[model samples]
Target: MSTDAVLVRVRALWEGLAAVPVSFSSATGVSVVVSPRALICPPGWMGVVALQGEAIVTAPSSGAAVAIRAAVARLSADGLVDPDLLGRALPLAEVLGPAALAYVDGDGFRPVSAGSLAVERLAVEDSELRQLLMVAGDQDAAESGLDEITSPAFVIRDGGKVIAAAGYRVWPSRTAHLCVLTAPDRRGQGLARVAGSAAVAHALEGGLLAQWRARASESRRVALALGFRELGAQLSVRLS
Candidate 1:
């Protein structure tokens, strides 16, 4: 898809998630709106998604939205979604993200080269999936989103032990939100890229847009290797 078409689809997804109409453009700036029903964050939280050259923000009230708009007025699209920068700019009790938002269309996906390792497609309920998560530990497991995947998992094993896996959950706008995790001890061996390739390929073959949100540098590198393009960022905040 062309960049313009990709932007349109991304905007539509956020509009639905925020439960509010959002306008995105090549025009540079941030636009904020109040939406208590916003799905971008839990109730009573504020959310911002920046893409292309603009940002769409959702806050708890008109007053709060206005304050966010002013605070981010002089910031660039990338800066608008940086959690640390936003924390400094606004009165916040907590900041939750600044995850890099990436996407890949069917044409852009680059599957990793075939190696000796084979990917096994397994049901989400497979005990191996849970085992992989347990070994990954709390923080890594939560960040991977593996526990929430909706599709079959593409798993990799080492000597009969599950070591890595990847999958996706269908989101609004036919988007496939990806989840990839590698056993901490099995990382740096390209296992993530291999597992992620299967998941991305499956999502694309199913005609869904593949979306990867990353905070870790290793995860970002894997996404880039799979031909995903980093187009924006998303941040969630709780105001004091």
Candidate 2:
């Protein structure tokens, strides 16, 4: 579970999600492939994943792939995944992401400082955890992806109410895609770090590569605190 090993697994995951054969390389600058079956994207959506000094553009059509490949030449390998820049440079009607994509192995994980806060392992479908997500509202709930986790949740409660939770969905290649949530009123209190740390520890014990995709700075900070290294970014675009 060295840094290099994690990156290799991540690259394979992305390539499989691309739905078409594609070779990503730092030497190639950017590689585009046409795949209507792009599993990482919604139907008709296109995606770009940049990692380890390489980039891959997955488009539903060759025409769109050609256009994106052309525009990305003017963009840096890292910038290829920036939604704002991609939206402007391409014929994008809507965009998602520019989110940080990170991963960690057992060696890199930093356990949480639980202190007085109690962390518990609960079912991913726990009723209390669902209530916590409802209180967090729609946008935050969706961002957390807590409802989609396949692993048990690591939760923190306050005054008998669940305030924060973290877990992961098993993705292809035995990757654990992390999902973490903190109550709106309970953020900035390190609850996320503690819950997320527990989840990471569980994933590592299960021999899964822990992955964290963070859009908010606070979320990114929590991931970093848990020793996840931000390797790249991901963007999904709907063509006009």
Which candidate number has the best lDDT?
Answer: 2
Estimate, for each residue in 124-217, the C-alpha lDDT of model 1 and write its tens digit: 8888888988988999999999989999999988888889999999999999999999999879999999999999999999999999999888
Candidate 1: 10-residue stretch with minimal lDDT? 22-31
What is candidate 2's lDDT per residue for 141-173, written digit by digit as tens?
998999999999999998899999999999999
Error of 2 at 116 (Å): 1.5
lDDT, candidate 2, equals 0.88
Shift in Å, residue 81, candidate 1: 1.3
TM-score of each: 0.95, 0.95
